[model samples]
Target: MNLFADIRALVISALDALAAEGALPDGLDTANVAVEPPRDPAHGDMATNAAMVLAKPAKAKPRDIAEALAPKLEADARIAAAEVAGPGFLNIRLASPVWQEVVARVLREGTAFGRSEMGQGQRVNVEYVSANPTGPLHVGHTRGAVFGDALASLLEYSGHEVTREYYINDGGAQVDVLARSVYNRYLEAHDLDVDWPEGTYPGDYLIAVGEALKDKVGDAYLDQPEDVWLADVRDFATDAMMDLIRADLALLGVEMDVFSSEKALYGTGKIEAAIAALDEKGLIYRGTLEPPKGKLPEDWEPREQTLFRSTDYGDDVDRPIKKSDGGWTYFAPDIAYHYDKTQRGFDQLIDVFGADHGGYVKRMKAAVAALTDGRVPLDIKLTQLVKLMQDGEQLKMSKRAGTFVTLADVVDLVGRDVTRFVMLTRKNDAPLDFDVSKALEQSKDNPVYYVQYAHARVQSVLRKAREQGIDVSEAALAGADLSGLTHPAEQALAAKLAEWPRLVEIAARTHEPHRVAFYLYELASGLHGLWNLGNTESALRFLQDDPAHSAAKIALPCAVSLVIAAGLGILGVAPAMEMR
Candidate 1:
């Protein structure tokens, strides 16, 4: 259950009652009313904006409204004290049992405790990691993959039916380059000398694809003309590339629910159908786009082209959908793809793209807006570049990728868990500094290790308690007399435990999963601080002289472990039971 939401509802009802009693203006809008944790602990447990939100509408001073509303809230059994503080804020502190109920609720709910129905079961499609399927995915694509997968998981947890998707750009020139590269390898497998030419892919990952092609066709196309073999090779090579891409994603624990192909859209009338939908809405036209702003190219000339009136939907300018040659532009198929998504009956759309695609965001959003007629919202998340560092120096690239590190190299070096956690330690738009040496270090400075270490410590405590014949299972702990958890140190942990359900809602509303990582870190810190307290004060220990007290004290640590396991589950990290 969301305690913050529960308290907010109570505060809203209390204000409405005051309005009914004519203590305030009639029909005052309470939508702006909010209940949040007080900035200063001295203020109280939760603070409300009842007076601040109603001051202007009620034509009364904020403090006067707060003073008038205080007693109404104080009448509830949940609020022990509701005092007006600092110019109209009402800080309310409840009795210890009020928080005790929060702990019991969490234990009963388990990992589903923080799951929210905020999305109201809306449908969402997340398109991500649509890397050029020309070779094995590199390190940059790895970040995008993890970010998209985590975001999809977060949305699912927040009560949205999510579809994870990847758009294959098989219609582009990059696939032709891949085809040529595989052809060279095919010749090599046939005992013929071949040289990878300029602008051709030279990655070793494609060598197997060529050998397989040779096996299937028995060298029938070995000496064929370009036109005769280009299409076939392109199709064959793109399929192989996708196979490699899928395996690469599997290695990193990513799975896409759908894989849409651009080439498939070409002959299927899907592109025309999507464009016709836009045309019906009067969003399509034939026009010459103005030369790119600020610096016109020397060869620039106005040319008539099929354009989408993107500016009508918030883009800087209309974008071209058909080239002057009458062939579809790169963006035409994308608009079609998104229109296809809209037709699928999704309620929302999210695209996870690299930083270089910042210019593409506006047009994509405009397309979705026009496609769904503003009924479905589109949110684009851009993942910034990750600078790979080793011993404070930039890691050098390999000849295979020309100037970039491969994803396999990274996974092999740090393993997938460390790589995933460290990548998510920052906001998506913020650059992540992944220092190789630091990520591998098992110290407090490493957040992954620090959080995992706290979990391991809790496990150690539980093992110690069990070895002494103390019952520590959920059944036994659920029946513990938590009243013995009266020590301030133990109570502090219980308070921290109360924040999870609230934090999940906040993070989900903001569409920011990194907030969960930050919350988990703070929770880990609080647990570790309480553990240190036990060393200095014997009474603070979980194992008490009285078995009844021992069970009660152990409940606090047990509760902490449950929340940690849940948080780690969301992060896709394994919670260590012991540090090795």
Candidate 2:
């Protein structure tokens, strides 16, 4: 149960009672009223800003409103005290039984304790890691992949029907470059001397693909012209690279529900349909854009091109949808792709992009807004770069990837669980420095280890209880007499446990999975704190002299493990049952 939500409801009920008695203004809007934990724990268990926010609207002094509301709240069986703090902020202290009930509820609910229905089953499409199918996914794409996958999982945990998607950039010139590069490698396979060109991919990863192409074709394209082999080799190389990418994603536990192809949009009338729909709204025009803001390039010209009036939807300027040569511009297919998504009837959309795409955000938003006629909302989250370091030095590039470290390299070095958890230790928009040595270290500085250790420690306590002939099952602990868990440390951890549901709703609402990671670290810290206390305070230990007392004491840490497992599950991490 969300204790904060319950208390906020109680405050609303009290405010309604005041309005009923004419002690406050009639029809006072209480939407902004909030009940949350006090910033300083010494203040109280919870605090509300009902009086402060409603003062001007209700035409009453905040202190008078708080003073009138205090008695009504205190009269409830849950509230121990409702004290009026500075500036009419009402601080509330719940009875000890409230925290006790939280522990029992956690035990009863298990890992489902924090699951929420806030999304109301709305369909959401989360598109991420749409790297070009030309080579292995690099570290930058890894950050986006992890962030997007975690976000999709977070949405699902909140009851959204989420589809994790990858948009293949196969329709671009890059794929053609990939074809030529593979052809060069193919000639090398046939014992031909090939000079490496500047724009061709020279990575060794394509060597196997080239050899495979030779095995299949067997001299069919030998000494052929560009037209005869370009299309066939492009298709073959794209498929092979995609296979490599799929394997790389598997290394990090990432899977896509849909892999949409950009090439499918070409020669299929999808791009035309998307642009025509926008044109029907008077957004398309033949116009020349203003020269970009700095020194104009020597080849710059005011050529009339097919443009979308993106400024109408808040973009800085109109955007080109087609070139003067009558070929579709890069943005045309993207608009079509999102239009395709909207047609699939998703209520909302989220695109996870690398930080380098920051410039493309407003234009894409404007396109979705125009395409949906402002019906659907699109959120673009740009994940910042990840700096992989080891022993105080930046790690070198991967030989296979040629220029950058592949996602597979990182996963192979640190493992899927550590790679995923460490990627989200910072906000999606913040730069993350993932130190390999630190990630593997069993120390508090390592967030993933610290969180896992908390879960493992609880499992150890439960195992000890089991050895002492105590029934440590969830049903038994849930039915235990938890009244004895009144120590300051125990109470504090229970309070933290009470915050899980609230935290889930907040993180899901903000589309930030980093909040879940941060909360897990704090909750783990709380459990660790209580575990340390048991060393000096014998009565606080889980395995006590009396079975009943032991059951009551062990229930708190048991609930802690349950919640940790739940949080880790959202992050796609398997909680460790024991540490080495």
Candidate 3:
């Protein structure tokens, strides 16, 4: 149960009642009315701006309106007091039983306590980690992978039908380079001397793919010309690199529901169909783009070409769909891919891209807007760079990846849970400094450790209670009388638990999964704070002389652990059963 929502509904009902009693005018819009935790907890449990928002529309003073509404709200059993704070804000303190019931509700719902139905089952397609299938995924892709996967989970928890997808960049010259790199490795596998060429991959990871190719076709393509082997090797090498990427993602607990191929869009009418759809709306034209701002390039020329009127949809300029040579431009396939997504009947689309692709955001949004006629909303999230540090210095590049650290290397060093949690410690558009030493630390400085320790502490308490012959099963704890949980510390922690469902909806609506990580850390801090309080106060301890009393006290931590586990699940991190 969302106490904030329930309280907001109560505030609306009070305003309606005031209207009926002639204390306020009728038909005041309450859409902007909100009930949230007070800025200062000392003010009240919840605060509302209903009086302030309705004052102008109701043709009444805010304080006058708040004064009239307070009595109507206090008449309800759940509301202990409603006081006008400042000039118009209404601060509400709920009855003590209300906070106690929040704990019991958490136990009954288990990890499902904060799950919301806000999306109403709308279909959402989340495309992320669409890195070129050239080699194993690197650190940049790792951030996008973690962010996208967590976002998909968050949407699912908030009742959106989500599809995790990866768009393979195989239709470009990059795959040809991959094929040639593998061919060099294939020659080395035969114990032959081969000169490394410019613009080809030199990663040691390709050594295995080269050896595997030899095993599959023994001497079949040996010493062959480019035409004879390029096509076959391109297909083979692309498949091998994709397998490596999949394994890398698995190391971090990410699995995609679909892997779309850029090459698949070619040799088909998909690109033409997508362009035709835009053309039908008069968004496609033959035009020459103006020279880019600043010093013009040596090869800059105003050439008439097939272009999409992206400016119509807020892009900086009209984008060319075809190059001067008559081949499809790089943006053509991307437009086609997004058009296919719109055709799939998804109500919404989300793309997780690396920070370097920030310029591509507007054009992609324009394409989807033109394709769907603004019917499907598209959100593009750019994950910024991750600076991997150890020993106060940046980590060296991976030998396997040749130029950057691979995702597997990070996961192998600090572990999957640590890698996933730490990646989300910062906002997606903000740069993150991931220190390996800090991530592995067992102190409060490490957010992942701190959060996990809270869950493990709850488990420890439950185990101690069970050993003492106090029944602490889900049903028993849920049914326990929580009336004695009146300590200020206990009430504060319960209030934090009541914010879970509301936080879920806010994070999901904003498409920000990092908020979940932040909330989990706050909740963990509250749990740990209360746990520390029990050391001095005999009444605060979970284990008391009376078994029934112990049961009642243990119920709060049980509820805390349940919420922590639920938050961790959305982040794709497994909750710690015990801290090592």
**Candidate 1 Cα errors over 4 Å, as ranges:** 398-402
CA lDDT of every candidate: 0.84, 0.93, 0.94
Error of 1 at 244 (Å): 1.3
Worst 10 residues of 2 by lDDT: 294-303
Give the TM-score of each candidate.
Answer: 0.96, 0.99, 0.99
Model 1 agreement with the true structure over 370-468: per-residue lDDT tens digits: 888799899999999998898999886755566578887788789887888887899999998888899989887888888888889889989988888
lDDT of 3 at 426: 96
Steric clash pairs (candidate 1): none
Cα error, residue 483 of model 2, in Å, equals: 0.4
Worst 10 residues of 3 by lDDT: 294-303
In the range 1-580, model 2's lDDT, one tens digit per residue, is 7889999999999999998998888888888999998999999899999999999998889999999999999999999999999989999998999999999999999999988898999999999999999999998899899889999999998989999999999999999999999999898899999988898899999999999999999888888999999999999999999999999999888889999999999999999999999999999998888888884678577788889999999999999999778999999999999999999999999999999899899999999999998999999999998899999999869989888899989998999999999999999999989999999999999999999999999999889889989999999998999999888889999999999999999999999999999999999999999889889999888889999999999999999999999888888888999998
